[model samples]
Target: MNFADISSDIRHNQIIELLLQNNNLSAAKIAAILNISSRSVEKHLAKLKQDKIIIRQGSKKYGT
Candidate 1:
């Protein structure tokens, strides 16, 4: 795999780990914790949701 792919995987894994520890974290919060952009965090979260790796439980504001 390319370096970018590996890096994305690492970030994805980090997001997953963080979620496991605290599912209530927001995308902005995750972005801050990961030292990345909120847009990037949103993209990663979209991917995880698309893959069924994570699912939203309620409305955007109240979901986990």
Candidate 2:
């Protein structure tokens, strides 16, 4: 499959994988690990939340 066809899924998968490895990672950290922008990470995260694929459990400052 071409990258253009699966790029969004790839990003979502990367985020899920990173969260699985360490659920406490911040969006910025995920972005750093994935070498993407934080905004992009946030977008994926929002989508995941809408799909009920992931959940946030704590405060933004010091929660996971």
Candidate 3:
């Protein structure tokens, strides 16, 4: 299932850019910035994970 079928490759690439911007921000963070739902962020992340495009780093608490 290529993202090109449902979403734009450039948009996904932008998501990748965000992930790489700072060790992969949380899905919540991305959604907040993009004005989307966390579930949507998760969806994008899942696709990225499946493609081995981004990775998960250590987690940090919110507002800590």
Task: Note each model's CA RMSD in angstroms.
Answer: 0.7, 2.1, 4.0
**In candidate 2, what are the lDDT values of residues 1-64, reduced to their tens digit?**
8886499888899899999999989989999998999999999999999999998887878877
TM-score of each: 0.94, 0.85, 0.68
Query: What order do you get sorting by TM-score, best first?
Result: 1, 2, 3
| Cα RMSD, model 2 | 2.1
Error of 3 at 64 (Å): 16
Could you tally the backbone clashes for each prediction?
A: 0, 0, 0
**What does candidate 3 score in Cα RMSD to the true structure?**
4.0
What is the clash tally of candidate 1?
A: 0
lDDT (Cα atoms) of all candidates against the true structure: 0.96, 0.90, 0.72
For model 3, the local distance difference test gives 0.72
Q: What ranges in model 1 sit over 4 Å off?
A: none
Give candidate 3's error at residue 27 in angstroms.
Answer: 0.6
> What are the per-residue Cα lDDT tens digits for candidate 3 across 1-64?
6867656566577678776686547777888887888997778877877888865555445421
Reference-based lDDT, residue 21, model 3: 81
Candidate 1 clashing pairs? none
